[model samples]
Target: MDTSKATGNNAPRNLTKGEATRRRILDAARKVFSENPYHAASVRMVGKAGGFDHPIIHYYFPKKAGLFECVMEEHVVEFRTFMEHWFDGLDAYTTDKGLAVFIERIIAFHIANKDLFRTLMQNTAHVENFDQFPASAQYEVFHDSFLKTFRKKVHHNASDEEVSKFVYSFTVLAANYLGASSTYARFLGMEGECDAYWDWVKETIHYLFLPRMEKIIFDSESK
Candidate 1:
């Protein structure tokens, strides 16, 4: 309701009762979207999930699209903060060790937030007009800086194209693995062993992928 407090810098501050209600609606929207496809998720569902009246949700977000956008914005803010914290000590470890640690943290984060990641991957994979979403701009800004930071850690001989491909491939692999962990676990006869599956993933990446990557990077540099 208060446009003055809606600015990026001022938002999410100590909220009045009304703003708190808005927050609840957004939180509910997130869960609803995560659990359902975009076409199936509805304002009424979000209202029921949040335990608020439909009118309250409409007052904050006039349409389902608006509510989805707000939910995405909130997720983007939270994810950016998490990534910044995760990359805090990037320079401290050896390159291979640092990358292995980074990958482990990423897997851990995905496992912890599997539903959210599933929603994101599904939306991006299915929505043809994904660029029109409000979160696209935020993602572009975050992605540019993310690649820049990754480039700095990579071997200087690695081309931008190579780095881009690496990032894209790694993201897809991690997201898909965590998002479909349950299905994969069942298929592999390890149903309900989510903890063990995650450990195996981390170890596989650390002992196998990390060594291969180190060799590739150094090999390229030597060439």
Candidate 2:
């Protein structure tokens, strides 16, 4: 084997000790936080999960809140990137067609980041100073990006605030439906029936919001 050749351009770069440790801690903390709510999660739990001591964890993250914020910041960037990719590729010429595709993309996005979705949904109400997190700022960026993509698809002109409200309503519904799937399944008795559950979601939107959405997409007189 040519060991020296292995270190050429195709070779993987190595992380510094501090970077490696921080990565490990972040990975462990993400899992721990995903499985438990924020109030229930602790720095010690993250440290133990990553096979590090209190000092090591503290050296990287001085506070549990800060550590959680870091995890959100990292994961939300990935989320926004996923959204941008889909938004950029949108080719639908009509609002309804574009929305149909966007709905499917939203479902896939939540499924791909189920862990982060669960963590964020579970911890949102419990955390203090929630608006100060980096994820909040990143969220605004993606929110505008979503609106910009959606705007071109609308049949009629709608104010940004109006479009924002309409989009936010559906997004929250999708988030809760998937983020708390277990509860919905158990309570609704749709266990092991993922397709049916999703169909119900679509049906709900179609029946309840379709009229309002139509008005927004087609009614030019609406102000």
Q: Which candidate is the best by lDDT?
A: 1
Question: Per-residue lDDT for 1-223 in model 2, tens only?
Answer: 1111111132224989888788899889988888788778888898888887867898888888788878878666666556555554334434455455555666666555666567766765665875865356644554565566567644556677888888777666766777677777777788743867766655565566657766775564334
Please, what are the lDDT tens digits per residue for candidate 1 over residues 1-223? 1111112232577899998998888778888988776777889999899997888888889988888767767666655656665555656767666666776677756655555566676566666676776466655654665666666645546666876776666666665666567766677678554677877666665665565455554444234
Which regions of candidate 2 are displaced past 4 Å?
1-13, 88-95, 127-156, 218-223
Q: Rate the local accuracy (lDDT) of all candidates.
A: 0.66, 0.66
Against the true structure, whose TM-score is highest? 1
* Candidate 1: stretches off by over 4 Å: 1-14, 111-115, 132-134, 138-145, 152-155, 216-223
